[model samples]
Target: MLDFAIFAVTFVIILVGAVLYLYPSSRSASGIPGLNPTEEKDGNLQDIVNRGSLHEFLASLHGQFGPVASFWFGGRPVVSLGSVDQLRQHINPNRTTDSFETMLKSLLGYQSGTGGGATEAVMRKKLYESAVNNTLEKNFPMLLKLVEELVGKWQSFPKDQHTPLCAHLLGLAMKAVTQLALGDRFRNDAEVIGFRKNHEAIWSEIGKGYLDGSMEKSSIRKEHYESALAEMETVLMSVAKDRKGQRSQTAFVDTLLQSNLTERQVMEDSMVFTLAGCVITANLCIWAVHFLSTSEEVQEKLHQELEDVLGSEPVSLDKIPQLRYFQQVLNETVRTAKLTPIAARLQENEGKVDQHIIPKETLVIYALGVVLQDADTWSRPYKFDPDRFTEDSARKSFSLLGFSGNQACPELRFAYTVATVVLSTVVRQLKLHQVKGQVVEARSELVSTPKDDTWITVSRRS
Candidate 1:
């Protein structure tokens, strides 16, 4: 009778699992009227993967289901918010916190059971900002040297020869960010290469967060992933140990060591900064060069600006703030590229947007895909015009979701300084032109990048 009972229970468990898999609910978890985000075919996650990029997928859903939609990612329900109004409504009005960090935390598996989570988050952000500022200050000389090396390489290339800017830019950014963020952890060229490999292993898997059960599926990938993470922590902990009392303006690890966060916390934060610092910065550099290659008028205007304020002078941080057109170029590039595409938050309590209820713990994603190109916010939404970012126009365009304002990604802000150095150093020396008949296509990875190589021909300016 006991054997029969055990067998019966096992059979029932399997039957329920089958039922749930075969017939997932299309309704809201709370069963509230108007609360349900519009569902695709059978409310399954296959639609997302079918749509190609997360950006493309979100746009398709938003087009069909209005500004807000519901989709499942391997049985997890997520609400996609595509409109600026929806974002304003969902995010705190005062802008105390943001969804970018939430999405990052989700990706990193950050769980702080400590109370005052918001306060802790803010504190950590300040710490990161402080580290970036110090690191940039000390590393500016090194950064310019790297930029010079890139310039020399470009100038060496025969005229009309195509250069793969993405790969070159990634190498440059990898060098700059690692030197700045990791400090003594990567002491030599060989050590940095090893770190870069391990970092890429970890960084690449971050995108796989969207791919369900992928990390566990491959033994080789799993081993590499584990080894990369462990190696990073080991290097970081050693640096942290060495630099406990000593502080260096160039060392992010030193700043982290001085922080109140635990060694593990510091390691995690370093990993986040190291990866985030390099990838998006490389993307920005690639696009900036691409746009300049395509637009001679903008290039000439930027060249003129550089000539006026920065003629043959050492590029410095103070000079960075004075370059208004340069700032506008960056703004336009970020708007057009949508560099960091999506950010999300969790609803702590029940809320409503235009009579539709959002139940507690709902995954609220800010797509930023459609909204950046929204006609109401941007004139000639498809065109790249830096002039549209005048002081009056700038105020209205202030709240770009992924990489702008007080709410912007901190790494983006850090990248901006380094990127400016790159742009200034390069443009001052070289005139960039598009490779004839070369087409650059932007695709979304963890960082949105050129699907094909971004080819540019550089000629030394007379």
Candidate 2:
């Protein structure tokens, strides 16, 4: 009797599994939407996976499937929306706190039980503003200083030895952002630098582990990540302790410390701020230099713009907006290399785009890289053209892809300020030339960065 009962249970489980496996994912009652029979026949799992790098695979789907396309990413249903009209209709005006908060918790390994309502609200508000205002504003001077340090270092080194543009840019970006987020006291301080280095290594390895599915099974990288986190926390905690009795400064660290929140909240917020700010700016700078070096005409035009506006003076924040063509060059670079190419958000509730229904809990990804390069949207999509972002074009709502509306990166406004300042300063003083036989390929990870070290020779412009 027991053997018969086990056999019946096994049979039911197998039947249920079979049913689930054969179940149609489409919401349509007929288990088939209006997709063309031919197209459906041709669409296969391999084709979906081969669309592009994981970052751009979704946009390729949208390109093939019109404005709305449903696909799977490793068993997870992903919906991609291409049209700005559809995106505006479906994605905007919703609070992203739940998604954003979840990401924060996961990345930093924080428990959800930490903060009260008021504390959480304050932390969120501060984080939002830090993404836009204080972080960027506070970091501008530091960015300038770091650029100067880089220039001095470059000038000191012999031109024959190739300058590792990628590494230097990363270091500079890391320094500037860390200073901005953690305060000047911790920017390059010994303990902070150690923590930053370890954290970067751990996160870099973790990204690899994630792609290879090893993070769960291995403790090596995870251990490093935890160690780095602890060190970072120690640093932040010390800073927070020191600031406990002090008057509030406008720094992000100060803002975080002063908020009526737990110590862990302060540390987690600072860690996110530091990591996010550094990677984006670093990748942007490296790509900007690569593009400027490869295209002499564009570089000349940018240099002329810098000369006309600032005229050999050190580039400053106040002078950034006036550097029109320089700004366009940066915009074009961003378009060419969508730094954060894809953004992922889980649907809070069911949403629809035209005929298709995006069920709740699906991951909705906006593929900025593909959208920015769409042939219909950008003329000569493959060409590097800064003029595409002219004031008129930008004002007319042509999607240039620096930052998306509603889903825009909170830190981009600040990133623009730092990037413009750095680019203008570098171009005004130096002539950048690509190293011989070294072709820079863009690498897409958490951000899009150069695959190999970007080497360039810089000489004082005569």
Candidate 3:
């Protein structure tokens, strides 16, 4: 769902900057309260940078301006909604269109099938979402096998050995997503390693490029980014070509290919899924473990639930929903971490969010980080209490924030299921512990992650 983080906010500014407009200096056209442009072209760009991240900026912006707020992006009007009421007014939970698909494609520079009619667009969206589910469902055993391989490695580690949580999970996620999306070819360690290198290069470059406008100014950086993108695309294209006219398990590429989507469409979707799926899945696991490591009560509760639900059995797809408290732990972890702190959608037409009048084509930001931790909505908002999600209202609030139910992005849905399996498998057998004297603070960026590489240790449970 938050697949938009790497490029959405910065992409909006760059896209709007190309077609300049002069917004009023004193107040927004929508009559919402916000910062005026610091410069004619920059708008409140410097303000966002000074605040460190768009998520951080929106938190402070809402704190001062209330639920509905506005800001200028390169002289264009941008509105941000920070409360549940404001979010419901702006985004319907049942909306068919997927906002992240648009933003992610724009950032990836993949324009295939973009000009299709609404029917075609909706068809493709359904195909993408279904493909994710199909991949996970059909490849459930492979998912378990891949995760178990990682767990096995950890099992062999010495009791005092501290693991590099982020790095390890990233590798596991890459293996899982690539193998499941692109098919069995990714089972080869060399193939997965090469793809990971290119993926990391492209991902890092894109994040840095959008943040500082480096891609435009530094020819070398641009060249590197393009080279990595080209290499990755080449790999995806090869896989897509091979999948053509071949009968196989309904993996992501196969589903897209079997449909009416063009070859370019298949390749674009494959690359997008691979990139977005791996990062989100990895970070979700990272935070889930990080939180579990610090709280023994939470861990014990989760372990007890796992015991009651599975009782010496490994996690299977059917048994997942039965692990209710485990789900709550993951949900609360997502809330506390504010993973994917912000998401955005463009206003299709003039709309009203509360009393504010949003204009057509306006860039609307969902200040999810602000809403997720709002005290009025969640009791002791900053506290990581999974029990808070036991109520039906918490689930509804979470869905409204686009982190649950049908409203969740395909990436998030995929991550949730994957995390369910991994956590159920690992935590069922090992007791996770936080590294002594180590502090992990979240760095709110494209994906929220620990400010540094987090280290954790695990001991075999008796």
Identify the leading candidate in terms of lDDT.
Answer: 3
TM-score of 3: 0.94
Task: List, residue by residue over 194-289, the lDDT tens digit for candidate 3.
Answer: 999998888775554665455676789778888999999999999988878887756888888888877788888998889888888999999998
TM-score of each: 0.87, 0.80, 0.94
Poorest stretch of ten by lDDT in candidate 2: 1-10
Predicted structure with the largest TM-score when compared to the true one: 3
Question: Model 1, 1-462: lDDT tens per residue?
Answer: 000001112112222232223324665533322233234322443455467766788778777777777765433456767776776676643244433444444455553313467677667777877888888877788788888888889989998898899889988888888877877555488977887788778877765433323555578887888788788778877767777776354687777787788877777777777777788788889898888888989888888888899887968887998998888898888878876565555566787766577876565666776777767677787788888888665545445354566666668887788778888877887888988878777776456778877889888888
In model 2, which runs have C-alpha deviations exceeding 4 angstroms?
1-52, 73-76, 83-85, 93-105, 111-123, 126-132, 135-140, 157-160, 187-189, 247-250, 391-407
Poorly placed runs, candidate 1 (over 4 Å): 1-43, 74-76, 93-102, 112-115, 184-187, 247-249, 391-395, 398-402
Question: What clash pairs does model 3 have?
Answer: none
Candidates sorted on lDDT, descending: 3, 1, 2
Number of colliding residue pairs in each model: 0, 0, 0
Please identify which of the two predictions, 1 or 2, would achieve the higher lDDT against the true structure: 1
